[model samples]
Target: MKATQALTTALKAELRRAGITYAQLAVHLDLAESSVKRIFSRGELTLARIDQVLALLQLDFVDLAREVAQATPARQALSAEQEAAVVADPHLLLVAICVQAHWTAAQILETYAITHAQLVAALTVLDRLGFIELRAHNRYRLKVDQTFRWRPDGPVMAFFRQHAVPDYFEGGFDGPGEQLALVHGQIAHARAADFHDRLQRLAQDFVHQHVADQVRPAGDKTAYTLVLGMRSWLFEPFRTLLRMPGAAPGIAPRAQARR
Candidate 1:
């Protein structure tokens, strides 16, 4: 990320972590709340303005840099070793996922069977893993950014694909706050890349919404998993029915960028 972008991102996260609303920040900066929101969204703040925000947040440039570094460890990619560590302990993995989702320690304790000590232990593991910076009273900020993703082929993804995916899909789609859409179409192989970008963007939108709704009461929020997928394939049974089995889209190679 560009320096300005990284700084802005870190600034926004600091504000969120501090529970400083845009309205609150606007009062600090002597700007309209709309302008503050725009500055955050578009990252249009100048250096002097960023300094002003930093002063308001009681953070210096070094603090901002540290936040940026923490937010983007390994370019926001986990090592195979790190993934293995997280997947090794089921509880640790659960805690990692919850913390990444911005769940509070109390929420995790209330929602799950984990004891406070167990939760603190899990949090200490995360702190060592650099996924979070443990703070006094168990209040912490996520070290990872909103756009962070687990390795596509890592142990965590493998575990989810083998276990969580099945459970996730078993849910009936006909319910409130639920959707399942399957669309198939043919386009030039090159045009398919466009959809890939859109799916990535949509996934990002979900994370952005998650961040925005953090201010909502924990009881008002529900855990949600978004699965976005696209591919050209004929079912095995349908493949047998296809008179022209030699011709099928997505069979060759997909020009997908790494997430």
Candidate 2:
């Protein structure tokens, strides 16, 4: 993950993203396909040669650097200490969630009541914890990707379980696009895995739709949280009759209304 290696990796990614094959790049660079492959494999191209590649891709060095920066993240799952620091202050926790949603400082200021100084302080702490990369003018870049997730039993999730959960479930869920359901059943392990895979794809589709709806006007959009859960569990009363009274096991299939 050295600087040179990162740049080379980004170059390769750009080529793939643009659907430009090595053979095509060979023609563009006026070199043999094997030679082009060797140069990419070794990542031993001169600055001029790299510039030529960038020209063919219609991208500049800055774009490649940005891609490299994005490809490199502050590893998934923060240490316990980091999670504790985030939950130490409620305002900081709110800011952290906003950052996870890619909210800009100005947008946060417009929506939340936190002071500008407080926001900056929280951003500084996140940068120190390697959760984000703070930049000038209160700008920052999220240091995690879609695969990034909170430690299940970490302090942040514990905080949510103790606080946010109550608030979240307090809703009626009878309103438009809201729902609450509970089901119990048993299924084979392999089918359960397939169920998990489909649930993951549904979650990803929700994410894609969120991104696509970002262009809508604020008035035309309403914030909604989609909580997905699949586990082998039965009602406590029912579980009391099962073999393992203290644990829940197996799975069942449930229908989604709109998904």
Candidate 3:
């Protein structure tokens, strides 16, 4: 499916799971119920209106955009020749490593086992591409606005951390502790599906609530499109991996006892 369509589908599903009727959403947005219905039915809302909804529902646009982008198939598949081109570019490797939550050149070199000159060359290329900026002599920070398209073999963790993870779960929780709380709550209630469902709804409600307030009567209708997409492939695997009895010692009390 197209990125826009995928995002709209995810957003609509989220609204449904929230038990928030169109009328209630309308009231919250201070718009006519019919208009809210039209927006939901059309699955298109102005970015400004979306902002309003996001503020109300406490969702982040960057996260939603990341989800959509990740779920959307690449516009053009990489042929062998194209793949070779990316592989030839040493900077791509540096870009990949910097995309992680917190990484440095020294750490990258140590982890990847590369020489100082090789690391410096890679960082220089990445800096030139605007994918990264030098924070200090050897320190760098990722530019979240930049878009990257590299081979799948080129560090999937960096791709997901820099791109996907930030997009879907942004603002839902501030830290790992908050995320663990949400996950634990879901497990405690035996509602993993519900937890996922609620997350989707939260994103939609946030957009709707915001858009209704910010959008002017004569605003550009075409400019308003809410795109919400998620990458289950990237995250679900990690979730499953972490949930294994061997992964969480405290949580897997039964498994520990059996041992």
Comparing candidate 1 with candidate 3, which one achieves the higher TM-score? Answer: 1
Q: Model 3: which ten-residue window has the lowest total lDDT?
A: 250-259
Best model per lDDT: 1
Clash number for model 2? 0
lDDT of 2 by residue, 102-193 (tens): 67688789999999999999999998988887766776666766556678899998988898777887777888787777666787889888
Q: Please, what's the RMSD in Å of model 1?
A: 5.8
Tens-digit lDDT track of model 3 for 1-259: 7665666665553354333466767887899999987886686787777776656544567645654564433222333454444346555544444542235565466666667777777666655655455433455444432123344455443455567555654444443323312121114434545655665676556445543433223343222212333222223454566746344322211100000
Model 1 residue runs over 4 Å out of place are 1-12, 22-65, 68-74, 242-247, 251-259
Q: Whole-model Cα lDDT per candidate?
A: 0.79, 0.78, 0.49
Candidate 1 on 1-259: residue-level lDDT in tens? Answer: 9988988888877788665789988998999999998988898989899899888876678778876776544337678999899999989999999988877788789889988988999999988888888876786667777668899889999999999877877777666577776665667778788878887898788888887888877688776778876667766786787667766545422322111
All candidates' TM-scores? Answer: 0.71, 0.69, 0.27
Clashes of 1: 0
Q: Is candidate 2 or candidate 3 better by TM-score?
A: 2
Clashing pairs in 2: none
Candidate 2 deviant stretches above 4 angstroms: 1-70, 243-259
